[model samples]
Target: MTTYTLNVVIDNKQLLLLKENCYTLCIAKKVRDQLGDKYNVVWKGTADFTQNNQFKWAEQYEVFALKSFKIGALVEAASKKEPIGHKQECIFNDSGVMEHAKADPNLGDDTFKVTNQYGATSFGISTILNGEHNTSYISPVIIKGHVVFAPVNDIRVWFALKLPTGTMFSDFTGEYVELQFGGDKTTVTVCYDDLGSWKLKDSNPGVVG
Candidate 1:
């Protein structure tokens, strides 16, 4: 038998309201009713390793189960750039609706550590409340080293860049391609005076369209 917990966050105010047995989806919807529709609900729980008395905690996993709620109180407060009901929102680059959220200390989930400690990151907010483990080290601490942001897996996405007319190319993502005199697709080297359409480079293996 698997047990579950319902987690909700109202801007910065977080609540793990469900205590009794209930459908996880139903609990998520309830929080959504009171909070609007912007907040995310992250579910955390333990898994049964065996039918015996022993269980597993080492193989723990954090799943993004559901996201259904909004804290109107929090959002309204953030626009003024102030703490809203014990939560603070920090927006970077002076843009992006997505803001980094910090929970109020008074709420008492040990999230207060983030407020006092600078240069350290919060390990896991939900993990702290669940009592699954201790020591809140949110973000990885960097100590004087070359930081590399390498993708764990190959990513496929569209790339659109303006190129100068007659510009020569060398290599990209370990692949190489050269542009021709020009037909339809925009040339790699030269920027066109007129609006040009984009097409896949010929050297791109297995990419046709």
Candidate 2:
């Protein structure tokens, strides 16, 4: 499990991965960076996508506690690269991988770095990610589930799993559903079926609808 503490200083914040190998933590930071501030992460844990969607990347999950961080605490990160130990291995999957990595592929020396915008310059550090699960497409597999009714005027109706990314729904038919990447894992896909207007059983964070 990758562990890190987010330290907020003045207007800037620092992400530090406290572990023997900085690989997982670094990857998590990159993903979080891409996510911006929409999602909150307190402590991220292992993300599991082990079934149905064969690809590990697509099944990947980041275990983390959520937090709606204050924008005022936001700061820029300085970027750079560094190296890790040669003996150290970066495996892509959680399953047995040492044998497959018998010979180092020489991903080469150097990895990325990020520092808090805070005045403290000590935040810069080097980290490495062994093997990364390739995430080209996540299965838009069908979901055999049910929906629920939320109060009117509220965006939430019902929720469903197995929705694809970038799906769109319409009200022209009186009620339509749309599935955006929603978030990191696209937690819930809001849609309607033969039943009355509905949504994913579970709603996306910060999304009332």
Candidate 3:
């Protein structure tokens, strides 16, 4: 069985996400600061991977997983070890949301790697996590790039920006008809904005709705 781990941030803290073995709809929302800053804020009421993870309860007032981790400690721990999540195309951005990535099949599994470490990108997050040799879901992606991933049946996607300084916002993971990506010489984009819109995570996480 292939196991996957996802990372998310809440209240300036980091946490890893995992599929639930129990609990149907009851969700968890922690007070990030009081929780010791070293926990994963996993939403208990998250929609199935096939559905849009977004819900409308009051826009910006919806509750979700609020795990918190000490940034300094996490970085230090990772540095002391081989790195917690350098394998599998799954990567966590500034929002602490995980995005599934893929490289060309012809390039081989070890071809794609995250940011260069020690002047070299660590090889094999995809290969290590995805030991499943049964099937493949290779879409038209490039340069060992990223693509928004949902459970095989989940159409769930983040709609609007979560928040400027927070983990979630009014816009939650919502449904869509299709998701696509493209790149040429200048830009490689997720085209999720066609469904809604968002700001560059590197440029700004966004403040207003």
lDDT of each: 0.19, 0.21, 0.22
Q: What's the true lDDT of residue 117 in model 2?
A: 22
The sequence of per-residue lDDT tens digits that candidate 2 reaches over residues 27-127 is 11122122121111111122222111111112222111111122212212222222223222222222311112122443222211121222222221112
Mind giving the per-residue lDDT tens digits that candidate 3 earns over 1-209?
Answer: 22222221121111112223321221212211111211121222232322212221110111111122222111111221122221233343345333344343433322232322122111111112112211011111121333222112111223221211112212223331211111221211122232233223232122222
- RMSD for each of the candidates: 24.4, 21.6, 19.2
The number of the candidate with the highest lDDT is 3
Worst 10 residues of 2 by lDDT: 146-155
User: How many clashes show up per model?
Assistant: 14, 23, 19
Where's the lowest-lDDT run of ten residues in candidate 1?
25-34
Candidate 1 lDDT (Cα, whole model)?
0.19
- Runs of candidate 2 with Cα error greater than 4 angstroms are 1-31, 38-191, 195-198, 202-209
Please list the residue runs of candidate 1 whose C-alpha ends up more than 4 Å from where it truly belongs after superposition. Answer: 1-42, 49-87, 94-127, 132-209
